[model samples]
Target: MSQHVFLRGMVAIRLFSALAELTGALLMWRFQRLETAVRINGLLGLVGPLVLTTTMALGLAGLAQSRLPAARLVWIGAGVGLILWGTRR
Candidate 1:
């Protein structure tokens, strides 16, 4: 029973992750083919970087959760830095 519950939780996480990915893809597609000097592409560009950073942060957080609690903060900080850098560039 315990194993089943764990598996169910994992499945739920995977499902939600996939949904998030799909949503991001659709949003990107919606902005694709738009000419330059437009707001949509600029906004969509921000989304890609933010999503990438967030995914990295989530992975880092999960790994840090297993290894060291203190290290999690470092990972989060790095993720935030990356997002900020990406958005600027």
Candidate 2:
């Protein structure tokens, strides 16, 4: 309902998505010595600079655009969807 909500949604979606991707990659590829739960927990730590850059880019592009390529309502709906999807519990 507020810009702050969108901002928080963006942060949550970006962070969780990146962490899930990285953790899945590591667990699926390297980190053979690590436990599956440990590999999953690796995502709980923090992301590096690269993912941060990507997150910033996505937020800026999505929020800063005066008129996004898609309808504003569509974007808002997508953002809501992302937030809902990331926090089902």
Candidate 3:
């Protein structure tokens, strides 16, 4: 895949994630209820991990295409794993 394509995919997903967060915040504000806000927050939570994983995948793919060393790729993957593990509730 082209580097440009990978970069664009990574950026687009992040932008979408941001938009989702904004929309969720607006929905919470519009509803004006704790229960509704919680529900919205719960749904928003899924969006974050999905976006993160997708963006990382695109970055890794681009790196792989560039012939990055296998060890470095493993380290990168491990770093992402640690981030997800550390953030989990």
Taking every candidate in turn, the Cα RMSD to the unseen true structure, in Å, is: 6.3, 9.0, 0.8
For model 2, residues 1-89, the per-residue Cα lDDT tens digits are 35565578568877687767776776756656557656566555344434554555556555655455567646765775676567555
In angstroms, how far off is 83's CA in candidate 2?
18
The parts of candidate 2 lying over 4 Å away from their true place are 31-89
lDDT of 1 at 22: 74
Model 1: per-residue lDDT, tens digit, 9-87?
5556656656766766676677675463255446556565555555555655555555657766786777778768876
Task: Write candidate 3's Cα lDDT for 45-83 as tens digits.
Answer: 988888888899999999999999999999999999999
Clash count, one per candidate: 0, 0, 0
Per-model TM against the reference: 0.41, 0.35, 0.95
Shift in Å, residue 61, candidate 2: 17
Q: Pick the candidate with the highest TM-score.
A: 3
| Candidate 1 CA-lDDT value | 0.60
Under the 3 Å rule for N, CA and C atoms, how many clashes does model 1 have? 0
Compared to the true structure, candidate 3 yields what TM-score? Answer: 0.95
Query: Cα lDDT of model 2 overall?
Result: 0.60
